[model samples]
Target: MNDWLLAPTLQGRTLRLESLSEVHAARLLRHLDEETTRYLSRGAPADLSVESVAGYLRALNAVPNRVNWAVVTNDGDVAGRISYSEVRPADRWVEIGTMLTTPFRGTTVNPEAKLLLLERAFEVLGANRVHFKVDSRNERSLRAMAKLGAVREGTLRRYQVRPDGFARDSVMFSILAEEWPAVREGLRERVDAALR
Candidate 1:
């Protein structure tokens, strides 16, 4: 088994990324309710009851190679969830994703989380690649990836079906080892700007 597949907790300021737990059930419910599932590939419902959300979180936590983390704000609010999944140690790759609440959107939270994850994946975990797959129609995510210097590799047609029963194309983006130095610098600059 690839070591990168090991689900691990990564922490950051304005966020505490711990492995997904049953304790996050309520927070997860709050998050899924704040966003529409139409643009989310993970298919989280917009209105999940506490029990239902707990069940969902438990199920997801049971999955291997998936480290789900609750994104806690500086105010100690559970703002959203993010994860590094499908870790392929042999290929030195991982996928980072999240369903951030509107309050956290377009904020430094997303990029800072990604930066921390990348630092761990590449510097600590010896990863060579980090991939981000987004719904082609999600302009926000695409724009964010572009800002981070992730190159658009290509599109996967009809990659999956959304909750609305429509086919969704996936836009694949990645930052490889050779490109990490520059990308890292670029991301650092962006995060620093947000701090200023």
Candidate 2:
């Protein structure tokens, strides 16, 4: 068991990813607007309280399956969340996911945040392939994944259930260890253009 897998911070200049703690649930709840919940596999409660979200984070923390982070913006507000889950330590593979808040919905934060995670996964964690799965209906996410140079391998039919109780198809994407440099460069340029 790696005790430090739960480290509390992963920061970039425009964004920061910190371990989701009780202190963050209140502000994190603020990011869970309707539009933000639409494509996500999980949804915020109708009137989610800080303590409840804290408990959720605690439960996730207890499980060895994944690590969740509160996506904090440059201004220090909780903007959303990103996680590295379904890790295969023996194979050095992992999946990346996030629930960006509504305000960050149409911004550069999403791509930039992902760039950070991808970097950590491949360069730091020495992963072989980093995977991303999006709902087939989420065109925006698909486009963003394309922008990051993820190759669409295929779709997972009826892969998971949606928040609305219907079966949702998942579009799978991946970036191999060999493709990181070019992908990273492309994302850096995209972020630069978006800021201008």
Candidate 3:
């Protein structure tokens, strides 16, 4: 949809969610490390070049229903990336995906990013449901999602194959429109507390 193609820049006290573009490739790649991507289906490339990442970002521009954002900290550093994918407008369902560099892991970047996206999904876009699928082995990520109040649905066994050949399970979590208010307030409180 056009909304995915032109996702307006979202701002928060701690970060800015800007459309992922070629120019952000270098900044995003600068902080990426093997440990940070260990949970992904394809591990960090042995050679993670700016050109490659840039090409990927550019290519994503044409993907119809996915919108990717560069998670930029207030000081103008690209801290990570987040996106809304698997968008099904007719069904009012969407999925959120994210990867944050270690430097910003413990900060408000994650929560604030969620607040913005969830707000847009439920409030602005009239989504009936928003979900996230995370590698089950990623305890930190699982905990983070649970902490945000997304109800755990179940695990998809052998959902993805890691680069090293491990069949990874994926944990599904979701928040329905009816559940949005509480989740939004929790995220707002977490993010707002940090802003103070």
TM-score (all chains, Cα) for each model = 0.88, 0.88, 0.90
Candidate 3 per-residue C-alpha lDDT over 31-107 given as tens digits, one digit per residue, 9 for 90 to 100: 88877777865455455799877876676666677888899998989998888866888888889988899888878
**lDDT accuracy of residue 109 in candidate 3:** 92
In terms of lDDT, the best-performing candidate is 3
Over all chains combined, what TM-score does candidate 1 have? 0.88
TM-score for candidate 3, please give it: 0.90
- Predicted structure 2: lDDT: 0.79
Give the per-residue Cα lDDT of candidate 2 at 99: 82
* Candidate 3, position 103, lDDT: 86
**TM-score: model 2 vs. ground truth:** 0.88
lDDT of every predicted structure (CA atoms): 0.76, 0.79, 0.85
**Model 1 lDDT per residue over 8-68, tens place:** 7677655666666678778656655534345777566435688777766776677677777
RMSD of each: 2.1, 2.3, 2.0
